[model samples]
Target: MVDVGDDAPTFSAPMTTPSGDIEEFSLADATDDGPVVLAFFPGAFTSVCASEMTTFRDRLDDLTDAGASLYGVSVDSPFALEEFATQNNLNFPLVSDIAKEVIDAYDVSMDFDALGVEGVAKRAVFVVDADGTVTYEWVSDDPGIEPDYEDVEAAVGDA
Candidate 1:
């Protein structure tokens, strides 16, 4: 895992955002604009995941007000993510981690026994600073707990 307070690594990858644009984005890319809240979901369209994303969507103004760009990542493909994003009305970008490379790179990939389910990225939220340093890190112990949005706002606001 990347240590907190360490110089943030450069995170760049090709992904399709929820808006249906396939672009190669990077931590440097988002950071160049401002602080980034990289919200990682286990998968698209799951109940808890949907609620969590909806919460973010509801607070999208707050996020932008904080000068933060939010991203949701999963092993699902861009097409599936697009549908999920549309269905949920999520305006943020959703990345394709189909190869599990990005999840592994962030060290959030785990074999979660989710709802007695199978492979998935453990529900985790990472607040990366403007320099790409991860400032806030969180993971679900039971795969059912949702990350507190207030905490995320505070972290991003501070960054």
Candidate 2:
């Protein structure tokens, strides 16, 4: 897994835009603007995932105020992500890692044998500074778990 102080692995992938359009999102481009928060969830529309996303939506202003941009990453397609964003009223972008490359690169990939789900992202959060260094990292094996929003905000503020 990517650790704090390590250079963040940059990636470009399909993402849901604020206008509900599918577009390419580049980590390099986003970090060029400011620090970034990458929150990886297992799947969209699931109870825990929805709650986590809504929480981030409600607290987005705090991160932006700290000069940070937030993105919710998942293995879902851009189309599904767009719908999920619209349903949740999410203001931030939702990145599509349908290829599972991002999850593998971050070492957060997991399998749910019982559910027949494979190569899905484990719940994880990585705070990357403008310089592309990971400033903070939190990962959970339990899909029901959520990151500490305040801690993420603090990390972004520090970044």
Candidate 3:
């Protein structure tokens, strides 16, 4: 597995937005020559992810002040994400991962119920530096746990 301190894998890929619109975005887009905090979740409309993302949204200003841009990723359809964002009022880009390509590349997928659940992304966080190096990555099973914002802020500021 690629862990913290490992170089980040930067790529430009297609991810639908909350409007069910297909768009290609680069991790570079969010970085803005600074740091980026990429949060990956299994799907949308879940309590855990909702809470996590809402928290991120609420504190986006602080994250930006720390020179970090926040992004959320999930395997839900763009249509689903649109409804989810409408319901939850998420401001940041809620990226679609219907194909699971990026999720698999990040090594955060799992298999279950004889399904392609392995293709769905697992909950995780990755902080990349200005040069696209992964400075920190946290992959965990407990989706209920909120991310360590203090750590994220420090990393972004120091990066």
Candidate 4:
């Protein structure tokens, strides 16, 4: 997993925003002057994923006030992400990692053999500084559990 102090791997990928517009998003571009929070969930429209994203959406101000932007990532397609964003009323970008490259680079891929789903991203969060360094990272084996928002906020604030 990419840890704190490590250089963040930058990528340009397609994302669906709250307005249902599909656009290309780049990590380096997002961190021009502040920190960014990348929230990787297993799949779109799942219960835990929905709840986590909704919490992030509801606390958008806290993140913005901390000089940070949040992006929700999953292996879902752009169409699904658009629908998900619309359904959740998310004001941030719901990124499409359909290629699984981002999740692999961050080492958050999961194996769900029993459910027959593989290469799904684990529940994870990454805070990256403007200089492209990873300031904080959290990965969970259990997808149902959400990351500590307070810790994430503090990390972004410190970054």
Query: lDDT tens string, model 2, 30-147?
Result: 9999999999999999999999999999999999999999999999999999999999999999999999999999999999999898999999999999999999999999999999
Which candidate order results from sorting by lDDT in descending order? 2, 4, 1, 3
- What ordering of candidates by TM-score runs from best to worst? 2, 4, 1, 3
- Pairs in clash, predicted candidate 4: none
Number of the predicted model whose TM-score against the real structure is largest: 2
Clash pairs for candidate 3: 8-134, 110-118
Which sections of candidate 1 miss by over 4 Å?
A: 112-119
TM-score of each: 0.89, 0.99, 0.85, 0.98
Q: Give the Å shift of residue 22 in candidate 4.
A: 0.2
lDDT of 4 by residue, 9-47 (tens): 899889998778999999999999689999999998889
Error of 2 at 158 (Å): 0.8
Clashes of each: 1, 0, 2, 0
Model 1 score (lDDT): 0.80
Report lDDT (CA) for all predictions.
0.80, 0.96, 0.76, 0.93
Q: Per-residue lDDT for 8-74 in model 3, tens only? A: 7666655656455667768876566588888898778878888888888787888788777777888
Candidate 2 backbone overlaps, count: 0
Candidate with top lDDT is 2
True-vs-predicted CA distance for residue 83, candidate 3, Å: 2.1
